[model samples]
Target chain A: MLDLSRVQKELVDCNRDKSSGVSIDLVGDQLSHLAGTISGPIGTPYEGGVFRIDIRLPDGYPFEPPKMQFVTKVWHPNISSQNGAICLDILKDQWSPALTLKTALLSLQALLSAPEPDDPQDAVVAQQYLRDYPTFLGTARYWTEAFARRVSIGTEEKVQKLVEMGFPEALVRTTLENAGGDENMALEKLCSG
Target chain B: MGWIKVITKESLLVAQREDLRNIMDLLEVSEKHARTLLIHHRWDADSLLAVFLEKERDRLFSEAGVTIAEPNVLAPLQSSQVTCNICNEDVSADAVTTMDCGHGFCNNCWTEHFIVKINDGQSRRIRCMFYKCNTICDEAIVRNLVSAKHPDLAERFDRFLLESYIEDNHKVKWCPSVPHCGNAIRVDGDGYCEVECSCGLQFCFSCSAEAHSPCSCLMWELWVKKCRDESETVNWITVNTKPCPRCLKPVEKNGGCNHVRCICGQDFCWLCGCAADQHHARSSCGSYKEEREKKTGQAKRDLFRYMHYYNRYKAHTDSLKLESKLKKAIQDMETISDSKEFSIKDFSWLTNGLYRLFRSRRVLSYSYPFAFYMFGDDLFKDEMTPEERELKQHLFEDLQQQLGANVEKLSHFIEESFDEFLQVDRIMGIRMQVINLSALIDNLCKKMYEFIENDLLGRLERVTHNIAPYESKGVERASELSDSWDSDDSLSMKTCNVDSYLQWDSSANGAGSSESGSPTDDSFDQSSSLDESGCSSRKRAKKEALDDPPFNLNLPAEGFDKN
Candidate 1:
């Protein structure tokens, strides 16, 4: 069984510090599924971007490392451009029970700043990072601008769009709130329920 | 003779005790620390000793996570409470367990960590839960904590640690028996030899395939693959069939003209295998191209050369299979001679000659594949000039033919129905011939191996191939390890689960009795061919022993015929 009390404590502890530049929120009511967001480190190609990561805690949570992968597309050598598989050692065999979701997100932010091209998840990006440095930087910057920028649309605008799709305004508001501000997850909830 | 020992599940700890004791005594460490070092070095004591001599004691101990120094003492606690970073909860001092690394965690969290790592198959080195702390958590702690919660998983962890002697070592390999005999064979000397497992399966120690010597392991692997591929039949199919352009499946023309239609509804010209339309079918597609035939000249010769050796190899193997039936008939003749009024009650000459025939015949059959690679352009083309290759081929073939002819003579004499002979002198003459023939065949087999090992393979450059040296007897039977290691009280208790051992003990006993006992004394004397059918069953029957009272596990290997 997952240590639900520890996970609850972790959530309370991680969210208490706003300056950590990493925050995790439950994707659903279940403690097993979560979403984490980390600000890209400043003075890198990924600066000014907020990268969303999909986190799933296995039953052996805290004992086994939580499974984290990039949901926001970013062009980096160590993070897969195609599927967002990470090649970070801490996420794998080096994972210790002491590590939390917040630490993992911070590690990802560090991976963005210092991409290890030699041990890469994306071979093409790694090759470009090695052979053609300027192009790799350009591609990474363009991808951050294209994908990792937070959707700036207002909640009113989201309500208007769903209202335009023939759902009642009050129901859309509750569903959007229930989906934790994720428009797609809210839309899925709206359609299914 | 190779010093090979058979290690069953029951004898696994006894097999591992030797090395573990050496490391424990040499390093003067506890069993857990010794195990950590041995597992780190993959149970190689000599290499561990080398590292011990070269490196400082602190470095060696720290590298393998064996903590000998006293852990740093902390300041006296204001209260009997401390916080475990993993759970981030305040706990009483009694609830916390500190490792040698001086890092402490709540007992609950530590137990959970051990369970997770053990379940993940990382039991061999479950390091401290603290991040970046490479100190391996003591095995006693792991066992004590894990057994408190999950006894079964702790047993699994124990088995994995015990099995590391075989699982992690290159010198030992589990016998590849179907439905698994639960046995491992440990070869002490060079691994480039063949061994007959106590379960009666004979295999090359290097590749673990059926014993195929004279042919190098590489050559034997290729020959088995080629034979399985049925490359000759495949070549014939390639010559006869054309792939359909639509489906790309090979389509043979059973009886048709130059145009052929596949089941997939694609029509193609048989001459060029190009898709055929109505207009192309009416016209002559093309003339039979002479250049295509010229291009396949080298491949054609290679195919013929392969067929030449393959045919002879198949012929000898086929004779070997048929001669096995002759073994039964000879045994019947022995029975008949026993009841008759003949003075000769001993049939040792007939059985000995038969055993010699089987051994030499195998040497002859495998020699074909050996020659196929030795002289062929594929393996050793540049190793010898054409003239040198020709001269060497003749020299090798001369020895092969001499061995082959003598083996046939021995087979012929063994098959004689001398029991029907009323004249006592007639039986005596045949006995003499059989005895002489057996020794001659044994000598010829020895010479063939010597010539191949010393003259042919020894002289080759740019490639090294070592065949298993010939034994005057057949493949060496791996001996059962004695029960002396039972004195290692530290392991014998936890090495195996008593219930599971009993389950196996009963199952093995059942396999033994149903197959009939005394398989060695009767069938083995007449023919070695009975080994496959009789030997394993009899070995299991003897293994039905070890009825030592309650987990002493003092099972000694039995039923070895010294002769």
Candidate 2:
């Protein structure tokens, strides 16, 4: 059993701390699956970008560490750019049951400011970070701008596009919102329905 | 000689308790605290005490996460509700438990934490749940709280704690028995020694491989892998078979003709291994080629070299297998001699000589592979000059040849039908020869081991190889640790003292050399008694053998002479 009460309590506790700039929200109806977003630390290449993380609480949650990975691809040494995987000791054998989702997210946020090149999830990025610092910083900043800085795709444009595909304007708007403001995805969902 | 003690499932608790008691007594701590210290230091009490001497007492205790709570402290008030930091839930005092480290968590949270750590296989050391608190949670509290929800997992926790003595301790190892005998062996001295388990399997304690004394553990490991790999067979296959030009399947040349036809209906020139293409009928492809000759020549040389060593190794192993059957024949001969009209009843020398033959034959078989590695370019190529290697090779081979010849002669003499000899003088002549050959073979084996140790391996600096010293009494059978835990305490105290064990070891070594004279007559008496008393005496004899001094080789010849 997942100890749903503790996870529920953790959610309430994390949300109460709005100043921490790290928050976890349920991804869907499932409490075990969550989405965590953290603002990159100030004065770093990742600043001004919101890094989305996919969080999964295994059944032995809190006792076993929660599995967290980068969802919004950010170029970093200790995180895989190809597939958003993290290399953090807290996520592995060093995980203590006392740690929670908020602390883990903070750790991941802290990792953005200081990447561990020696123990790397992305070998290419680690090599780049080790051999050429300026190039690595520029590439990382570019990746943040391209992928992580959420381009609020014009919601009005998606609503219009889905509505023109012959769905109700209200349904199109909800579907577009559900599809994260993607016009084509909202249209596909409308047509499939 | 280092003493190796076999610890059966029945004795594991006894073996571990002794160490725990020593730590408990020395440290003036509870059993749980002692166990924590012992488990941390890998059950080496001396090292744990050394750490105590080197560091402050409080530092040592705190470093291992041991916090001994002061006695006579009042319990926390039972009336108030407390909040568990883990779940952040307010619960009544009775619903929460406080560990000795003073970290309190609700029972529900504690059970959950214990379950998680146990499932993660970290049962031996489940720390208190407070962040940055390193104190290990008391085992009793974990057990009491866990068994409430899950009895089986609590049992698993106990098992894990019990098995840590073997799993963590370097001196102790589980017998590498398949279908596991549930027995572990502990060596009191040097780790590199041979021990026979109570399960009747003798293995090198260091590598857990079969007892191969003259061959170092590395050499034995390589020899076993090489034999299992059948590299020589593969070599022969590569030498004889050529791939078909069309299908690429391996095709063997069954005849002397250069034109060969594959089963796939492809014709190829055997010399060039090329598809026929109008060149097959002319036999022009048979012309000498340097490349082909060189490749085949190298393969031929490698195959011959492998065959030379493999044949000798296989020959002795086969002889050993065949000679094992001689045990039954010798037992039958003993029965015949017992019932004969003649007064000669004792045939202990025959049985003793037969055992010597078996032991020597095994040594002789393994010696071939040992020689293969010792003299070949594979291991010691740069260690010795070619001339030095040749000199050492001759010295080793001479001993090997002498041992091999004497072993064969001992085997032959032991197999003779001496009970059929009506003349007492003829039987005596056979007995003298068997005894003399047994002694000679034992001496030759010891000499060969000495040569291998001092002459061959001793000179090498880049590599260090150690063989289990030759034991004339055969691989030492590890005696069972006394099942009583109290005796183990004294035994461990003696082992820890070091000087006493050294004196005992030296004295035992002296006794061992003298006892290497002959197999004791008691074994013959026990076997004879078995025949007279049916199956019961055999069981008693086996029990007696386990308890008896392993080597009692100095039986008087007059006992056999009178018989």
Candidate 3:
């Protein structure tokens, strides 16, 4: 079983430092699934964007490392822009149980500032980062601005959009919230239902 | 050649203890600490010692996460209560466990952590629970705490630790027997030799494949894969068939003009594999095109070359399988001869000759592949000049032919039922032929190996390929390490006992006398005479017996005919 108490303590500990711009919240009632947000490191291509990460604590948590991936796509060499997978060593075989969720998020924040191009999850981005630094930076910044930054269209606009798609207003509101305020994905969920 | 030692399940601990004792004595450390060091160095004592010499002792220990701290440093406070960082629980000093790394956690939490690490296959190096602490928890403590709660996991931990000696060490390997014979082989020297496990399976220690002496492991691997796959058949098909232009199905032209129509009603040219139209229907596709002719000619030549080697290799391999049936027939003939009150009581020569045929046939089959790689442009093209390669190929093929001819003669003689012959002289004559042919084939095999080792592969400098040296008697059966090595007394005496035990085991297994190529009576006498000696001379005698088959071919024919 997951060390729920340790995860609980980690959540409380991470939330205590909200000013650090990294926080984790439970995705569901279960402590096993969580969502975290980390502000991009300053003076990097991803600056001013808040990247959301999906975190899952396996049954052997603390012993086995938690599985974490980006939910909001940000272009980086060591992260897959297509699926938001990460290729950090500490997230893999080098993980120490002593390291917490907050430290892992901080490592991601550091990875954004200093991308290891040699060991890459995105070969195209890594090649771009290596061969043309300016173009890579511009593309990364564009991706961060387009995907990582959350747009404030107001709640009324989202409700009105879904209502126009002929979804019940209550269902639209909950599905919109569940989809994390992504309008196209909310439409997909509504259409699937 | 390297000495291959077969380590059975019963001798695993005894086998590991030799290394463990060496490290412990050298470092002046406890057994657990030495094991930690060995595990960290992957059970290589020489490398561990090299690191010890290169680095400071404290650094060596600390780098491997081995902490031999002063007891006072890890001693608990006078206060009765201590808090374990893992569980965040308060426990009395008695309920807490302090590791060598000086990190203390409640016994419950430590036990849980050990269980998790052990189950996760990290039993060999379970680190301290404290965050970022590089110290590995002392194994003795892990065992003691974990065994208190779960004995099975502790047993698993111990097995993993024991197996790490073989699994981690480069010089040792488990006998790759299916259903697992519970034995591992350790090579004390070069690992390229062949060894017969105590379970009676012979394999190359390096590749774990069947013994393929005179063929390097790479050659043997490629040859086996080539034989297993339908690559030759595919090549033949590619050379023979042309795809229909419309259906794209392969169409084989039996004996017709270039303009052949497929069964799918698609007409195609066989020569160029292009669609045929009404405009040049008189087989104009057969007109010579340099590029197409060159490509087709090359493909045909390659296919023919492969077929030549494959056919010969397959022929010998098929004969080996067929000759195996001779064993049952020979056994039946032995029974018939035994009941007939024949003059000759011993017919081990027939069985021995049959065995020689099987061995030589295998050598013959593998020799084709060896020749394929040696003389061909695939591997040794740049290693030798054309003339040098031609001369060496002829020398090798001459030896191959001599061995092949004698092997066939031996096979023919062994298949003869001289028991049906009423004349004693004829049976004795057949016996002489069988025995002489066996010895001749054995010598030929040895000579071929010499040619391969010294003349063929030996001349190459850029590529290093070592084959298992030819053993005329057979693949050497690996003897078990003596049980007395486990005890702490009389090392020389134990070594002597292990030698005698191996001889006794070989004799019991029936390979000793038969492989030595001596009549059963001579081996019985030699073994009995060696039994009287106390120590070192027996090993020397055993080694001599293993090197040469002690057959007295000069004995008069009347001596055997009088029976």
Give the best candidate by DockQ: 1
Whole-model lDDT per candidate: 0.78, 0.78, 0.78
Name the regions of candidate 1 deviating beyond 4 angstroms.
Answer: A150-153, A158-193, B69-79, B231-303, B325-341, B417-419, B483-563
Per-residue lDDT of B188-284 in model 2, one digit per residue for the tens? 8888788877777888888988878778888889888877787666656668998787776679998997778999999988778878956576765
| lDDT over C-alpha atoms for residue B408 of model 3 | 79
Task: Compare candidates 1 and 3 on DockQ and give the better one.
Answer: 1
**Candidate 1: residue pairs that collide:** none
> Which parts of model 2 are misplaced by more than 4 Å?
A150-193, B70-74, B77-79, B231-296, B332-342, B417-422, B483-551, B554-563
Model 1 earns a TM-score of 0.78
Across B248-290, the per-residue lDDT of candidate 3 in tens digits comes to 6668887756778999998777767777877655765667666
* Residue A97 displacement (Å), model 1: 0.4
Q: Candidate 1: lDDT of B399?
A: 90
Question: What residue pairs are clashing in model 2?
Answer: B344-B563, B518-B553
Candidate 2 lDDT score at position B175: 87
DockQ of every model listed? 0.60, 0.51, 0.35
Every candidate's chain B TM-score: 0.74, 0.78, 0.75
lDDT of 2 at B465: 93
